[model samples]
Target chain A: MPILIKDRSMVTPREAIAEGDFSIGSNVYRREKKVVSQVIGLVTIKDNFVSVVPLKGKYLPRVGDLVIGKVTDVSLSTWIVDIASPYPGVMRTSTSLARRFDPIKDKTRKIFDVGEVIVAKVFSFDRTRDPMLTVRSDNRGGGNSPYLGKLVGGRVIDVSPSKIPRLIGRRGSMISTIKHYTNCKMIVGQNGRVWFKGNNFEDELLVLRAIQKIDREAHTTGLTDRIKNFLEEAKKNMPTPSKEKQSDKEKRSEKKS
Target chain B: MAKNKEETVLITKDGIRHDGRKREDLREISFDVGVLDRADGSCLIQWGRNKILAAVYGPRELHPKHMQMPGQAYIRCEYRMATFSVPDRKSPAPKRREKEISKLLGEALNPALFTYLYPRSVIDVFIEVLQADGGTRCAAITAASLALADAGIPMRDLVTGVAAGNLSDKIVLDLDDVEDKEGLGDLPIAYLPNLEKVVLLQSDGIFTPDQYKEALDMLVPACKKIYQLQRKAITDKYSQINEAVQKDIEAEEKDKPAKDKKKAEDSKAKDDKKAKKADDGKKSKASDKEEKKKKGLKKSSKKKDDKKQASKEKEAKKD
Candidate 1:
């Protein structure tokens, strides 16, 4: 079935899971069997309840998952940050950040602000409302000090947390295509948020559309070419001064007859 | 199939491809059905970006006897992403994605084809993606349907695959390699245009129920659009074959004049005797040919009639 698209909203495999509708692609299957934690997805109905039947290969982060995260806040004893899930996650102080035990003298403030993002790992979790998180997986600075920085000016996209694999396409075929084409650097958060940075705005915007295309049709084949074509169209649609250098006459001719 | 991180999918600095393609549009789509004469049905669909070939074997046998039911037929789908299809290459075996797709495709096609009539038999669909981009599974499903139709399987419906996804929570149709990886909410779908039923769906980022449904609604029309193309493709294939066959028959009969002389020599004697016995047949044909010739017509109705009659007679004889 073609997806049940809502008004311009990008729905995730996870939302379908939360709806009590088990998912295979975007299609929802009513809960039947005892789909366990490995059931990578679920249907969330009533917002409080969910039925998730994970895949066998799916794994829950035990003490550590070697994940990356961003800092959301810096409290007295602990810090709060988004960990790519509905679950609120926290990291304790005294791990780093304030090497001199002086929050005010912390030189790390130069790098991070209230909305700064970072790459860190899941230190531990209690599986409750708030799981303990840490950036000090390698025992560097555990708090939101060092790796915390701005994810500069590229378009950001969100995806179903569940479809990260597809967006990445197998071993990163999808992301690789975007990077190679747009000459951009992208970071895909486990939380389904993507950050892109390109040398310029044109390539960056193209990267955005290209990633949007992949996110839309991750299940499609020839995704690279399809995306390539889409961008070609988008580029053409956008009036530009460098017409000669931008045209895909050869590729168009190949597509023609 | 695994994606390659280094590869650029779309949009270079000057709007050129990483390899180069125009900013807008599609890769070339080349397809041929029944490429393999032996398979019940087959097709090779090459969408500029990827190459895939599909073959349909049978509604013929239902093996492992136990798997067969008494009143209904079974459709078996085996989806495999070829080892070399992706950048890093994949395992030859059917993995979770492939298995899930096969099942979904089987369901999507169930309503369209008349599978129930062929009880105790299994219709086997095998899909192979030689190269994959973003939507390999959707491609596989779309190709499988065409292959099945090419194989001459009786089905109630024809299925078309289409997809749309969300990036930064904005919905877009047909995600590309890069968008799929970097975008939010990848929703890959397969459906029948006529029936308006969704057979398969998968998504990435979060979507509100309303937004998801809207995406689906938008996709139905697109599915139909593609279905029309598929229909045209199928029709065009058959028509080309029909035209070729007709031309071949004409060519085969090109030597008729020489053959006729030999036949005339052999049956000339008998025909002369018969003509003498029935003089009216010759007289009427000559008059018909002459009337048209006098009217300044280069072609004669008599010859046209003769050709039709000759073909009909040949057909009868062959039968």
Candidate 2:
């Protein structure tokens, strides 16, 4: 069996990648024993297994994914959340709350109001049904950790979901670098929402710019080093903020978007 | 039947047509893919004097829950011609011809796509003909398929379309406006080049059994030729982006080595120029059309009218 395409090369839709007994991966289909690409993407071959990483696409939700979602409507039983996916997510009050929740006795809006953002784990998802979300952290139980529950007092920015892996870098190297340099406490969701709060507004803005740069250059090689140098340059040139203005600057930046 | 056979000569004895093209020649065809900023995928195709802009959106949610398909996504196509696209201004309303073409095009593109992957969603294709000469439906189908592929929708094969005309008992490829109006017969077909499947076929006027077979033979190879152009258009866009990224990386490396005052300033200027070139490489050619639209809609239509009038005068001189 011969591999038709070179590894790490770009391919358009329906272009043949390999023939014969190769294990298929995402964005590829088996046609007459030949593996063909299903989208315009970069093809990767590792150990006889081939996959195509799409350059652009909407996020498709998977189970166990950490996601940031905005509450759109709160009913008596469930809160409808927009998770930046093709399908909406449903967060039930019975599982989301720390204490036992009474649907008839308590109002759903009291627990999680409309337009509030929450960091949640996708508990269940199938193509036929909407994804089910749980705010309860898996290890410690209640939503007390920074990774779960209502996200408050942080700036949330969006990147393309397909570029999330590049943003995170190799084993969190890219994200850790950004966090260490900017001194920002950041949480990145699988759905491409980044929430971070730094000591000053300038650090937050620097993180925002860095993320945008990464998104733009995601397909390029040596991106991690480029971003590290970019962050360093900005840190050296930034004017120091006055201590008193930090608090007000946070409020102003929050209102800008 | 050539009703005005005595008044016009579509093909000369030397095998040249009215436009000075050989019997097998096609009009110039080019594609600019990913030209729209907001669309998920878009393409602007210039086939001869016909200009069509196609934009694709979704595989996203289909509204009105009852209308959602159980096993596959629905293909929704809308074909609209601009009011000033033709010599006579078209009314700003959907006509029966537009609706029929829309339905046929949606079906023409269905088998090529893997619609079942996104069940219950809808893929919407919108084609706007800014200028129409002839064979617009064929051109619309050709561009719509490219737009779908650009949108990253899974496809088994790409579709290509072209029309074959019967002029003075000779089958010719790619009929223009005048030949389409006065020619004896016109046969347009959309084919999946690699798969060898004819997704759409329409016949108008008269064709003997032998002439019909000859037309099909000419049309298939013509579509294959056009398909090569479509593939090149797509690959060229990606290669341009790759080159831009490579240049940016090289420029960044060059900036790191200079420390002297004059040398640093010189490197900075060079870096700026490199970045500008990178931007120009990635920029779509649609910027000119965008500028024309910004100049005022009425003004651009008037400009198109002048160009059409000049061509019309040239055609009269040939007659």
Indicate which candidate wins on DockQ: 2
lDDT per residue as tens, model 2, B1-319:
4466666789998889999999999999999999998888899999999999999998777898888987888999999999999999999899999999999999999999989888888899999999999999889988998889888788888889999999988999999989998889999999999788999999999899999999999999999999999888888998898888788878878876652354466456555545676554443334433333334446546767999999999999999
DockQ of 1: 0.01
lDDT of 1 by residue, B185-268 (tens): 778788866556778878877888877987777677777777776766776775564466456445535755665575466455
| Cα deviation of B232, candidate 2, in Å | 1.4
For model 1, give the RMSD to the true fold: 33.3
Put down candidate 1 lDDT per residue, A1-257, tens digits, no spaces.
22222222222121222323333332233333311121112222332333332111112334544334567776655667665443445666565232444556653445444566655556565433245665443535565333433565565566545456767776777777777666688887655677888866777888877765555454434556655555554543443323334366656877896
Q: Chain A TM-score per model, please list them.
A: 0.57, 0.88
For model 2 the local lDDT of residue B212 reads 96
Cα-based TM-score, every candidate? 0.43, 0.84
Shift of residue B112 alpha carbon in model 2, Å? 1.1
Judged by DockQ cut-offs, the docking class of candidate 2 is acceptable
Q: Share of real interface contacts recovered by each model?
A: 0.00, 0.51
